[model samples]
Target: MPELKGVDGLSEPLLRLYSSLAGENPWVEFLTVLRRQLHASFATIILTPPTARTPAIVVTPGVPDFEIGAAVKHFSKDPFVGLPEGRVLTANEFVGREAYRQSCFYQQYVASYGIEDIMGLDLLAKSGFQMRMRICCGAGRSGFTEEDKQWLGYFVPHLRAALDLYERFEIEKGEENIYDTAVEQLSVGSILLDGSGAVIRCNLIARNLLEQRDGIRLVNNRLAFSDTANERSFRDFLRASGPALTSRISFMQAERHSGKPSLGIIARRLTMPPSLKLGFCPAIAVFITDPQQQAGVTGAAVANVLRLTPMEAEIAASLANGLSLLQISEVFGITQNTVRAHLRSVFSKVGVSRQSQLVQRVRTSVSGLIVQMSSGSGAPRRRSRQGAPLLHSAGAGQDRPQVKQTRRLSHVP
Candidate 1:
């Protein structure tokens, strides 16, 4: 391995590649820039290991899609695959010029693409994963020189480091996606705003509420209440909740839409370490709650809390939604008589006489249970009334007498 010399000219392009890798630039653009720097007709980086089912990543610029497809189809037979790991080799090293011109790989794949000679550097191989870089020249052009190979060799370590950094960045982005999804499922709408009151991040629920434009909306990327006075006050509250301040403010904004309750907005300044504050983190978090929005109750809560069977829980959940016995039977594909029987059993267990009483009881008891269940076990599995069998314990005979008094019922008469 010769010392890489006269490489000062390559510094700018190399730095651009590193910066692009650090940001959100596409890999193909980086490869295109790299190919121009190498003065090659085409450039590619491949990660293919013997034990791997497929290539992990393939970046090729200035290569036709058909040629790439053909290359993939015949990759096992390519002479480059036989090269020693982490070594630089030219096409002529594997075959003489005459033999190369007569080879099947050259005629079927390389020739069709007008590629005559290839110079490849096997940059790294670890745990059965090999990473390689290749530069190719067109037909009738001179092959890659020893200087070119040495120049690429010098940058192999930096390329490996950049790739490792990219992988870590991808992992962190995936974790951020998980966090965003979890927050979106929250019952309360959450919005993160900068010091200037511009929205930095918001969950799906917040987006939906903004779309409704009933009480609040996004104006010029900032949260705005329907009322001008409320909007002005909200903006001032956000400005006060800056990084230098630790304050909490709560306000109620009346809904412009009829029959909807006013929304409760709570803004709290986020406390962060000095280092984190320097990273442009949001200064305030706003939680919005709409009292008119119906709360979701999972059937699993009814089963676990009320000690009902899965089928009974399904019927009880439907009843809690103010569904008529006939409607519940239609929805579950069961007879109305069967629905009535299930309803009677549910009323006995829940200590509720009238349908309204049952609905109120279930709603009040299970409203807060959704947050706990979603946070702990996620949404409950919905059971099919037709497919799920009614479960009865042998001890039911003893517990039936105390069914109405077993649990302290809520909103039951």
Candidate 2:
């Protein structure tokens, strides 16, 4: 191998390629851009495992259309795949040393894959991470020059950023899809409202529920759920629950005009997943209403879902109904200071910031559990169902306190 020169000629195109990849999918754009710029026969993007032995091509496009999975499977045989993991196996080094290089892995697996000389860029994610990215460009009629490698290398970092964004977008999109499916499968009418109380998203059930009458029609920027005290309560709940740390509030009303007799409001805060705490995305507030089946988990049900102590569950249920600290304290016949202390413990155990966040988390978690149950995956859990006593001896609504018999319903004897 000769001494590699600086990337003087390729800098301009490389910069343009980088700019194009920003806020866009890298692999698709790379194949399209490289085909015209590098004039390559084929281009592929491969993801290599930590060991760098298995190069799974996540995306491939360009000339010499190949079997996507099989092409990547074959490339895993090449020892050069490990180069990104700090193992440098160059073409010059492998060609003369390894006899297998004589028969290209692609040729052995799929003849006429038409890969002659290849230029690759080794890409790794965050520092100290084990994943690798390989960009392979094959020579159709004529082989690649050293210049092609320098050009591709110049654009590799930009492509890597785009790939990372694309992967995240896909993940969030998939999660949203699952959420939508869950909402649709159930009889619950679910709606997710933004901080401003605008409907960001609502399922089919919510649509039918709200659109049946003109009472809750979507005006320019507001929702008119009802004309009486129900609308005012809904507004109050949304305002209080919008920024709650470990609490949520929700509203439900029977379609009186539609001949159903259900009307209620519940509010709770949403919890950010521990994994997503690294970013600054806003916490979500979920709203759901139903006339037939009551909305929200019963006190016993929520206690089971969160594995909360009976006292904690009572506090949570109170907060979920949009009760202030003073209100909750009065309701439970406890001092305000005691209510504050209990809430702190609730936030810590449930992993949320304020009351609103907690309520949102509880609703989302319970809804998810219900969805899983409907799919035959499992059942909703309650503290009482967890072989724990349902109530404390000192709290309101106390019962005769004997050692309650317990049974484990999760795994039967």
Clashes (backbone N, CA, C under 3 Å), per candidate, total 0, 40
- Candidate 1 per-residue lDDT, tens place, 379-405, comes to 222222343211111122221111111
Off by over 4 Å in 2: 1-26, 48-57, 62-66, 72-80, 86-101, 109-111, 126-142, 159-187, 211-222, 233-255, 263-284, 291-413
Which candidate number has the best TM-score? 1
**Shift in Å, residue 311, candidate 1:** 23
What lDDT score goes with residue 336 in model 2? 91
Q: Mind giving the per-residue lDDT tens digits that candidate 2 earns over 267-342? A: 4445555565345432334444555654544444456567677778778876775778888888889999988888
Model 2, 219: alpha-carbon shift in Å?
4.1
